[model samples]
Target: MADKHNDISSTELRANTPEQAVLSTPTDDIHVANGAADKSKNQKIRKATNIILIVVAFLFVFHLIADRYIPSTDLGRVRGFVVPITPQVSGEVIEILTTPNTLIRKGQVLARINPRDYEIALFTAEQNVTQAGQNMGALTANVTAAKAKVVNAEANFTNAKVQSKRIFTMVEQQVMSEADADNARAELASAEAGVASAKADLAKAEERLGSEGENNTAVKSALLALEQAELNLARSEIKAPTDGVASNFRLKEGFYANAGQPVMTFISSEDVWIEANFRENSLGNMQAGDKVEFALDYAPGEVFTGKVAYIDYGVDWGQSEQTGKLAQTTGQTGWLRQSQRFPVTIHFDDEEAKGLRRVGGQADVMVYTEENSLMNLFGKFWIRVVSWFSYVR
Candidate 1:
């Protein structure tokens, strides 16, 4: 009975011992080491994640600075001067001398008007000038004849006066009859009246002849009419005023073109420019002579460089609209307002832009300011990417 109790107590003591003390083997050691290894790996992963996050944050900040300092806008367009072609004289279109989209030079004849009426007018004016000249010649002849008549009458009057004085003396000395003296007085009176009439006629003739040969009032007036007629005849041919391309050639044969009305639009080939509508915030560092790069939709995959030529001083806001008697105010939505864009004109550096005929075509523009940094390089890269994307988009 004592041996059995002792055996049972020993078994209970063995059963009550901890498992770690009873089973302290290699497997247990491996399990403990694996737990510690897992904890250390988690700490290393957290450290690496923290470092990556810091780098990403720094990069994001750098990109933001790049976008702000270097501004860009997609709302750009090719621009050129548009001229309205109008005729100075009203007439029927006798001929159309130009075709649509044809290049034209200054003073090139675009069309012709029916000049028959103008020619007839010019001929009539010339005939009137000839008639004026004939009339002037007749007046000059009349003046010369009147002068001769005045000289003859003056000689007769002088002889008559001498005879009257001799007759009066003869009557007073009783060497002549009273009837003879009376006859002599009558002849003298007739001669004096003739002389006075001749002088009046001469004065009238001289008044008709002006200071110079062609300075007669009638001749001058006729000459002016002739000049005007010639001018009108010349104006019958419509000519271009500048070098450009003729567009919208709608004038056909027999169409009556009104005076001073636009017949076509002429796009000047003098200089081409880009009109970029940039947000107000983007214009802070922008100025004239700033370098710019642009890509056109028509000329995709090609980047053209230029410089900022000018900035618009004003924009179309409430100030431009015609308002009522009361002043107008601009309405805005809360917090989510869009910035207004102003126009900035850019001029191309080379003549390559002249090859593009797409006026008002879409373009992407980037203005490189005086600030030279890595940000600009990024901006250039971004623009190149955009230019490439333009090919597919």
Candidate 2:
């Protein structure tokens, strides 16, 4: 019975010993468990890193595809012929007919120079022409008078020659004295000199007369001066060149305007376009006549349609009228280079856009060079996004 009791105690001790070992565990086993937990944490970190890399790669590829298929740019401007309103002739501003920022029709008078000076010039030119005509008439009369004088002098010369010949014959026949014949000869010589003088006066008169009627050189020159005076007087009105709006109108009633100097800003509304700057790499499929869409900064949440007019071929970064200078060195010399941008002209499909044109206005543009539905849809969404973002901007 004691041996049996001993065996039962040993069995219970063995079972309790296994439970104690499980509760207390060795340092080596604890280290192993800690290492396993560390491994599991490392695996979780690696999985998160891989997911992030995949997302980044996908976004990079998507950007490449979108950029290639449907190129978009926020660097766009509403471009038109913004001309400087310069006076053809110089004068003091006497009156302004046009109001500020008003629509002016073609050939509408914008302002007027002091016409008193031009009026005086026109009057002087008219007087010069009158004087020229009067002079021409006097010259014609002088030619007629000179011709009559020449004929009279020739008749006298003929009469003197006949009388001298008769007197010489009479002297030779002993009917007249030598003194009388000498007197007749002297008269003949005098008559001949008078005829020569009269002919010279007639020639002088004819030469001064020039061509007949309006063909006269002096008359034509006077007429030309008169025409120029009229032109200058008309130019003093300062009419608008085309149908458009005016700006920067600092011209006043007393301002002195110089010839060929800009006094006001006039933009032509006949031709309007969007000058969009697009990245060079994204312009692979871009060509003229491609469809386009854009949004103006002023008109937020509005999408306007257009067509690609043309793509610029060159950039004049270093070109200038000034010369004899070395080229400027590039600021960056790293392996990565900044992308080059080229201008792409776009024409609005909306006819109302022309009437509502504003030069130098900011815009966001997108060019669809191909019929890529997915990419184009993305582009449309992108531009509308920009249009909505314009409100925040």
Candidate 3:
């Protein structure tokens, strides 16, 4: 019986050992759990690393955009000079020396008027002056001749007096007749009358000369007419006042140009500037002499530098709403007021590249300003108060 029980127990132990071997061998499960844990840790590490990288990239880009390359505001604009040319005299436009978009220099003749009429008028005026001078000269010569005649007459009168004296002495001595004395007296009287007439003629000539020298209305009128003729003559040739490009040149050969008529416009490309119509609110930090940078629509790649030249005296707020302004001018369009805009002029320092810019071209401008510490702090506090009040309301 003991031998039989031992054989059965050995067999059971062998079968149980196989089952235990299957349950106890846990190496594969351990490897799988270890792999899962490693994978989870790796995923968490990758997510954290990605988050860090994203933050770093964002900061770098934000810094670049803020410090180095700030976004431009298209609200800015470009401005330039616009001038009108008008004729001072009335005449036919004989020639047109410029075309549209043509570049020209200062003092360059853009057009000419029909100069024949002006020339003829000038010649007539000159002739009138010459004739007047000749007339004056003739009068002067006449006076000179009259003076000589007066001298001759005086001499004759003296001789007649001497003869009369001799005749009187003879009569007293009973050697000459009283008739001879009477005749000598009559001759002296005639000589004296002749001298008086000559002196009167000389005085008349002197008066004529004096009239021209002092308050001669007729001479003054003539001089004014002559001056007008000369001015008209000068107006025949249209010359530019400064070096610039001529535009709106509409006059052609043989076209009549009237007085005070618009001939053409001269745009000075040499003096370039940007007139920014900034809002009144935007002007709080803006001032003259502030640094500015600009970009032009025509030349997008170029960065033009400038400074604030001046700010407007007052804001134009009327029609400000329609015009999108922060302030309004008193006499502006509307009465039920809205926002208004003030104009600020900025002068460009670069002269070399000014020629490339055109009037009315759009430009973006930026005014460099330092933040005000007190103002900023006050503004933040005010904003928070306003927000709280809005919520309460």
lDDT of 3 by residue, 1-393 (tens): 999999777666645676764554457669889999999999999999999999999987764443222222335555666778888888888787777677778878888888889889988887877776666667778778888988998898888888888888998898988888788789889988988988898898777755553244445556777899999998898887667778766566888777886867788776667777664556665678876666666664566677889988985333435455566445546654554567778888867346667887766666654444333343334333433332333
User: How would the candidate models be sorted by lDDT, starting from the highest?
Assistant: 2, 1, 3
In candidate 2, which residue pairs get closer than 3 Å at backbone N, Cα or C atoms, i.e. clash? none
Question: lDDT: which is higher, 1 or 3?
Answer: 1
**Model 2 TM-score, 2 decimals:** 0.75
Per-residue lDDT of model 2, residues 91-142, tens digit only: 9998999877788899999998888888999999999999999999999999
Return whichever of 2 and 3 wins on TM-score: 2
Q: For model 2, where is the 10-residue window of minimal lDDT? A: 19-28
**Pairs of residues clashing in candidate 1:** none
TM-scores, each model vs. reference: 0.71, 0.75, 0.62
What's the true lDDT of residue 51 in model 2? 100
lDDT of 1 by residue, 71-127 (tens): 899999989888888888888999988998877888899999999999999999999
- Candidates by TM-score, descending order: 2, 1, 3
Best by lDDT: 2
